[model samples]
Target: MVDERTRYFRRLRRLRNSARRWSVMGGGLAAAAAVLTPYAGIGLADAAWAAAAGASVALAGWRWRDHKALAALPAPPPPDPALAGQRLVAAVERFPAGRTVVHELRRQRTRYALRGSAVAQAWDRLDRAAGTLSALAGRLTGPGEAAVLEAAVAERWLRDLGQRVASVERAIPLSPVDQRPVLASSHDSLAGQFTEGVTAYERLVAAAAGYVAEDGQPVVDERHPTLTRLIEATDRMRGIAEGLSELRRHPAV
Candidate 1:
């Protein structure tokens, strides 16, 4: 999986690199053509070649923008197999599992020195909550009435979360490195979208908390599923938010 992710990043980097080079080359040629056309005589062949060159330049610029948008996105971290496997186990485990829940609580309590204050904290809580939800989701074995209901709710939440994560991921490519005004506007817009996603996840979490309080049970029920979905959504939002925090911490080249 790590190998696959690395390969993906490598391919994207190569594509962006190629696009940047092409944009520069095309723009240069376009400028050169404009300069030469006046003095070189307006022959039919010259006009045709110039038109082709102009089109190429336009295409290059389009590619450049496309690639740049991708490059600007926050790079996702390589997955930890050990961690993933551990989380999988935790997900199947009963709620309030000492081993799983405590670990996450500690991480949240620490308050790591990261930027994007609200976004960062929100994500940490979401991650911690997700681990327990994973366990609950897994424990709902068989297609019993409760099981089916929980699964449906959990699945819906998961799907919504996936969409929110994708939105933030797409926005990452819009980051601006230079030009303060343009960068600020772009950064705020992208960051705002991310924040909204986070907020949506939080509402879900709150709903989950309400459910657990009403039942006083560790196992997830139909109501629990809605909460579970929100918790999971929070988890993904946190992951993406964490990425944004890191991006802000370390300026891009």
Candidate 2:
């Protein structure tokens, strides 16, 4: 998929081309009218001048709308696949089969990342979570421990994020001319929420790294404060997902 920066630049280039075309056309028409005023009847020259003025006005209006739409769009976040991977590894590390699970998840993530689409990567992460959860079902039933619970929470959040990402991907291409503002707003809001979620996940992962286990059970650290951050992030992501869902339901006309 095209990155936001590339998409924005492409749109800018198109707008510039359009403006140039209109300017050239308007100037040519005005020059033709001026040259013909001496040879042709004044009435015909006046008609040509009016047409030229109309073209100029149309170009101005188009530029104004284009500028507003472009300004309304949110800037894309910088790529941080490394950081995102670190957080994912940290979250996976909280499980007993950390090595195997992390390896598989990383492998899947890498495979999809190589596919060259953000939307695909998001879906791959969700697939990883689903696969992991399926494998953990038998083991989780044996005990009700903090580590197991944490894994479950992380999986759910990953799945939720994936769904939201999918919704955004679908809504993006359906944006109509009249709905540019709403689409831009939704894009901005989703980006902000996704960034916050990633940050929270990173903090949770860091805290999990320092986690201590007693008698094979995970112990909580008062100083680390991981769970609260995770919960907050998950809630925010869920809310954003719902908002995206709403957008999909009432797509821009």
Instruction: For candidate 2, report its TM-score.
Output: 0.30
- Measured by TM-score, the strongest candidate is 2
- Candidate 2 versus truth, CA RMSD in Å, comes to 26.4
> How do the residues 1-253 of candidate 2 rate in per-residue lDDT, one tens digit apiece?
3456767777877876777777677767767777766643578657868687677858856875786687677867765778667777777788879977777766667455435334454455445444544454444433434655765686567546645655665566688878867876775676556545554544544344334223235355543457668988999999999999999999999
lDDT of 1 by residue, 153-223 (tens): 65456434534444454445575546556645654565465556555555554555555455455555445
Looking at candidate 2, the ten consecutive residues that score lowest on lDDT are 207-216
Off by over 4 Å in 2: 1-144, 213-253
Runs of candidate 1 with Cα error greater than 4 angstroms are 1-4, 38-41, 81-253
Q: Pairing residues by index, what is the TM-score of model 1?
A: 0.28
Model 2 pairs whose backbones collide:
none
**What are the lDDT figures for the candidates, one per model?**
0.60, 0.63
- Backbone clashes under 3 angstroms, per model: 6, 0
Positional deviation of residue 90's Cα in model 2 after best superposition, in angstroms? 27
